[model samples]
Target: MDDLVINNLSNKGIRTGKQYLEGLRDDRNVWIHGRKVQDVTNENGLKSCAHTLANFIDRQHEPKYINHLTYLDDDGDRCALAFKTPKSKEDIKDRGKSYYEWAKWSNGYFGRTPDYKNASLMSFASASTFLEKGIKGQGGKVMAQNMVNYYNYVRKNDKVLTHTLVNPTYNHQQGYKGKFSEKVALQVIKETDAGIIVNGARLLATLGPLADEIEVFPSTVLKATPDNIPFAFAFALPIATKGLRLICRDSYDLGKSHFDAPLSSRYEEMDAVIIFDNVLVPWERIFMYGEPELCNPAFSATNAVVHMMHQVACLKLAKSEFMVGLMTSIVKASGRDKDLYTKGLIAEVMQMTESIRALLFSAEEQAHEDQFGNYIPLRYPLETSRNLYPRMYPRMVEILQLLGASSLMATPSEADFANEISEDVEKYFQLSNLDSKNRVAMFRLAHDVAISGFGSRQALYERYFFGPPALMASSYYDLYNKDELMERIDSLLSE
Candidate 1:
C-alpha cells in the first residue's frame, strides 16, 4: 500500500467484497434473530448480495471511473472521489455534468452506494470546520470525528459505507408521551461517559449489512421535551456493534431466478429494521443529543440535500433513459413501434424522464455556496425532483411493466428452460426471433422493476423517501421566499 498506488485505488474505490465483509465484522454493532451475528460476512441470506454490491465499488477503481469520479486532493499526497458542486452558475452546470458522468455507470441501479454516504459525511465535515471556538454542540464533535474517520478509512482502504436515519415506523399522531411512542420510535434510555445507551430501533437501514458503518440520525424534526431528548441523537456504530440487530424484510429475489430478478437480488438496497438494545455509542461516534432543535436543522443546514439530490436525480434519470431505450427496443422488436397507442405511451415516459434529467441538471448547474462555504445545489429545482421523482418513478416503472405485457408475467422459470420441458417453454415464450436466454433476460429485468416484490418495495421507497408529499411540500413552502414572490405578484397586479 504505497502512497501513489493506494491513492490510485482510493480514486477508484477498489475495495473488495471480502474487504467490505471484514470491515463489517470488525467490532461493528449488528444482530440478527435472537443472537448477535458473529459472521455477517458469510450469513446465508446476506453474503452473496453484499458481495455483489462490493463488486460495484471495486469497479470504481477501474480505468473507467478513475478519471471523472476521482481527483487529487489539495495536498496532492492523497486522492479523493471526484465530484463537483457549483459556487457559481457555471460551476453548478458543471456539477450536473459530473453527476451525469457518475450516474451513467449505474444506470440508476446503485443509487445509495457508499459514495452517497461520503457525500453527506463531506458536508458534515465541511460544516463542522466552522464550529464556534470554545463551544462544542452536543454530538457535533462526535459527528466531526466520524466524518474524519470515515474519510480517512475510505481513503486508505477503499471501502464503502451506508446509513439509516429514520426509525422503522411512522407515528405522526403519537407524541413522545403516547404509549405507542417507543413502539414506533428509537430512543435513548441511559447516558454514559463511553457513550449513550440507546434502546429501540431505526428503520430503512438500506445497505446496512454491507456497509462498514451505520450512521444513525433522526429523520424528522425533533421537539426537545424531557421525554424526547433521547430520540434527538446522532451517532455512528460499526455494523457489528453489540446489541444491534438488523431484521431484514421478506426477500423479493426468492420468488424469481437471478436472471429474472436482475435488480432485485443485487439492487434490493436491502433495507431493515435496526433494533438497538442498549447499544453503546462511543463518545467519538456520537453526533447530537439533547438538542432537538439543532438535530433536524443541523442536518438541514449542510450540503447534504445538494449532494443527495445530485446522486438520486442523476441515477434515476439514467435509469429512466435506459428504460425508455429498452421499451423502444422492445417495441421495435415486437413490431409495435409504429402503433399509435404504443408510441404515445413511450412519448409520455420519455417526456417524464427527460424532464427529470433537465431539472436535476439545472439544480446542479445552479448550485450555490452555503454559509459554511461548501457548494450546494440550488434548492427549488432539487426540491422539485425530490417532489416529482417519487411519484414519477413508480409511474415510469408501471409503464415499463405495461409495455412488457405478457412477456413480463409469462416468462418460463430458468429451471424450466433447463429441464425436460425446455423445448416447450422456449417455443411458447421466446419472442421476436431472439433465443430463450436473451428474451428471458429482458423479461427478468422487467419482473424485477415492475412485477416482483422489488417493484412493490421501490414504490414504497419513493413515496416516503423524503417524507410524505405533505411534509415535502411544507419544507418547500418554508424554504421558499414567499415574500419576494408576493411582492412580484403585487407589482404585476398593480400594472
Candidate 2:
C-alpha cells in the first residue's frame, strides 16, 4: 500500500517544480547567467531534478518505510533520515543497515539523498554534547538548533537541501604566494549590522540545483587565519539567493544518445563551482563566524568523515551487489554459464562485493561510543575500507570491461534499432540466443558503469571524495592505539 517508488512523491505535500519556482523568483542570491534564475523549480534543467529529489523525500511518509526510514527526535516529530545518534551499539548497526536498504532500492544512483544529510546532522547533534572548554568552537548552541530546525522543516514540509563545503581552487599554493602567508583566502571582506558579507567561492557543491536549501560550511581544505576568518563562517540559505551563481562543469553527456550516454543523462548529480559575490549570511542562519580556529576541527568533530564513509560504502556495496548479479545473469544469458573461466570471473566479482560488505559490517558492528554519546563506526575498518575502495573500484570497473569483451563497444544505439536498418544491426550484433534489445541494454548498462564520464567521476570521487588519503591514513594512526598492539609483542618477548 506504500508508494515507495521515486515518482510517487506527490502524496507527501512536497512542492512541485511550479511551487519551488515561485519561492526562488524573489531570491536575489541565485544566478545562472547575467539574468537571475527566476524560477529554479520550473527551469529547463533544474526543475526536473528538484522535483525528482522532493519526490524521494515523500517516500519516507509511507507506512512501511516511515518507521524504519525515519525516527522521532527530542521534539517528538517523526523526521525522515534525520540522523539518529545511536544510544547503543545496536543503534549504529541499525542506522547502517537502514541506509543500505535505501541504497539497494535506488541502485545507488541517488547518492546525495536526504538520508545522507540526516545522518551527518544527527552526528553533529550527538557530538555537540561533548564540548569541553577551549576545544575551538566547542559548545555549538546554534549547530544544535540548526540541526533540529532543518530536520523539523524537512520533516513537515518536503524541503530539498544541499551543502557546499570545500574551498574553490586547489592551485593556491603556487598561485597566491604572498596572499597565502598573509591569509589571502576568502577572508571577511566586511562585517555588517545584520550579518557578515563574504566574497570568494566554494567548489563542487554536487546537489545544488536539485536542492531548495543550501548549507555553507568551512571545509578542511581552507586553512584558517585572521584574514580568512570571514570565510570560516557557516550558514544556511535558499538555493536561489542573489549573488550565488553556480557555474556547472562541462556537461559529461557530450550529446551522445541516451542509450550510449546512459549514466550522463540521468546520474549527473554532481555540480561544481559555487561562486559567491558579496553573499550575505543572516545572523539567525549563521552557525559559526570569525572563529577561524573552529573551522576545520569543527567540521571534523561532527564525525562527518565516518558518516560519509559509511554512507557511500553502503551504496557502493549495493551497487557492487547489483553489478555482480547482472554479470552472473549475463554470463547465463550468453550461454557461457558452464564455462569455467566465465564462472571464475563472476565469482571474483561476487568476492569483491562480499569483501566490501564485510568491511561495512565490521565498521558497523565494532562502532564505539563517542564523547558526545553518539556511536561512531570503528575508525580503522571504516578508514581502511574508504582508502581501499577507491583503488579497488577502478579494478572492478576493469573487470567488467574485460568480461564485457568487444561486445560492449559493438552495441548499436537505440535509434539504430528503431530505424529501418534495425535488421542489419541486429543480425550482426545479436548474441547467443538473446534478443537484440536485451543485449543492447546489457552492454549499455555495462558501459555506463564501466567507462563513461559518470564512471570516471565516480572513480575520482572515491579517491579524493572523502578528504585526502594521507589524512585518512594519519587519522587511522592517530585514533588507533598502537600501545595495545605493542603490548602483545612485549608479552611475547618477556616470556
Candidate 3:
C-alpha cells in the first residue's frame, strides 16, 4: 500500500498556508508596471492574492474542513480531494461535492483554483494510454507514463498550477489556427537529447504569478500538418524554470482596504502573457508532441474536456449563486424586496443560478464510464453550461447594476469613516435597513463586482472564458444530436 501513490513530498498531510506562500518566493520571472517583482509574497498588488490563495490552501488542513477538502491516500498521505480519480458514479458525485465546495469558498470570484487543473490532470493521467497513440515526440516515447508521473508529483506535493492554451496572434485569423508566427508565438525552436527548446509567448495565464508550475498545452485550433508541427505539443514546467517570464497586465488589487474593494483586494488572480525564451522542457515533462491530429482531439478522446467542464460547471453555478445572494442582499438592505420590479429583477438571477445548478446535476446524473475506466460526468450538459455561462454572467452583472442603481457608485470609502468626516459619513450613507457603515461595505462589494475596473475585466473574462462564443456555439451545433432528431422529423414528413 505504501507504493500505491508514489512520491516523496515534504509533508504527508496538507501543507499550511505559510508553507504555500514560501513556495512563491522563488526566482520565477514576474513583471508588473515594467519592473521585475522580487517576491510575490510581499509585492503590493500581487502579494494580496498570493496570501489569499495560501489561505485557501490552509482551509484544507482545518479540523472543520479537513474531511471535505482532502482524503488520505493509500500511501498514507492525506491528499487533496481534487486529485481523486472517479471510479464509479458515486465517486463522480463526491468529486462534484468537493468541486462545488472549493468554488463556493471564494464565492466564485477566484477563477483559477488549483482543483481546476487537478481535474484535467486526473483525466489525462487516467487515460494515459491515449498519449501512447501519438508519434514519438522530440523529447522521447514515454509521454503517457510521463503524464501519470506528473499527476502523482503534483498530487503528492499539492502544487498550484496555471495553464496557457492560446498563442497571441498579430493577425487574429491566421495566428489562432496554429499558424504561429516564428517571432511572436510559442513554438519549438530546436530539439536536443536534453529536451525541446521553445520560444515566443502565450496569453491569459490567470494565476501565473502565484503558481508553482504551468501547463503549456496545445491550442484547440491547431492544424495537423508539417507547418504546424512546432506548435503541437504539451508540457509542464516549474514557474522558476530559467528563461520563463510572465508579463502581467495592470493589477486590479490597488492595496485598498478589504471593506473598500472586497473582491479586488483579495481575489486579484493576475492575468499575464507568458514569454518562453528558449526554455528547455525535459523529456519526462512532455505529455504529447509532434502530432497535431492527436493534439486537437486529445482532450476529448481522453475525456479531459468533460472533466474540466464538470469543474467549470460547478464554478459557474457558484458564481451565479453569489450574484443572486448579492442581489437579494441589496434589495433587503435597501427595503426594495417588497417592490414588484425589484422582486422581478432578483428572480431573474435566481433563475440563472438554478439553470446552472440544473445543468451541473444533469451532467453528473448522466455520468458514464469512459474507455479508460474513469466514470466521467457527461460532457454534453457540462458543455451546455460552458456555452451558456459566458453569456449568462454578463447579464448577471447587469442585474446587479440595475438593482443597486446609484448605491453601487455613491458608496463612501473605508477611509471616509475614519477621517474627520466620520459623523457626516455615518449620517448621510445610512439605508432603510442598513446602517451607514454596513451599507457602505455591502455596496462597495457590489461596486467591485459590477462597476469597478475589476468588474469590467470580469465581464470580458466571462465573455470569452472558453474562447469566442460564436465559435463555441458553432461547435455545439456540430455536436448536437441532429441525426436522431432529424430521423423523427423525416418520419413525420413522409406521413
By lDDT, the best candidate is: 3
Clash-forming residue pairs, model 2: 28-241, 28-242, 29-241, 29-242, 29-243, 29-244, 30-241, 30-242, 83-118
For 150-200, candidate 2 gives per-residue lDDT tens digits of: 544544445556787766453556333312222323445777886667777
For model 1, where is the 10-residue window of minimal lDDT?
Answer: 1-10
lDDT of 3 by residue, 366-392 (tens): 999889878999888888999988989
Estimate the TM-score of every prediction: 0.86, 0.83, 0.96
Clashes of each: 19, 9, 0
Tens-place lDDT per residue, model 1, 1-495, is 122121233433345555665656655444444455556656555665666676765565678766555555544532335232234665445445555666665567656666566666666666665321111344355456555554555555555566777665456566332222676578877888766787886767777766766778666655646666667766776666778777776556453446756777666566778888878777656656666666666657765766777667776788789889778877876778989999998998899888987887677666677887667777788778888888788887888877887788876667887899988887876667566677777777777778778777877787776666887888888888789889999999999
- TM-score, cand. 1: 0.86
Candidate structures ordered by TM-score, highest first: 3, 1, 2
Which regions in candidate 2 have their CA more than 4 angstroms from the true location? 1-48, 72-76, 130-151, 154-158, 170-185, 221-228, 253-262, 486-495
* Each model's lDDT: 0.66, 0.65, 0.87
Candidate 1, 46: how far from true, in Å? 2.3
Residue 430 C-alpha lDDT in model 2: 69
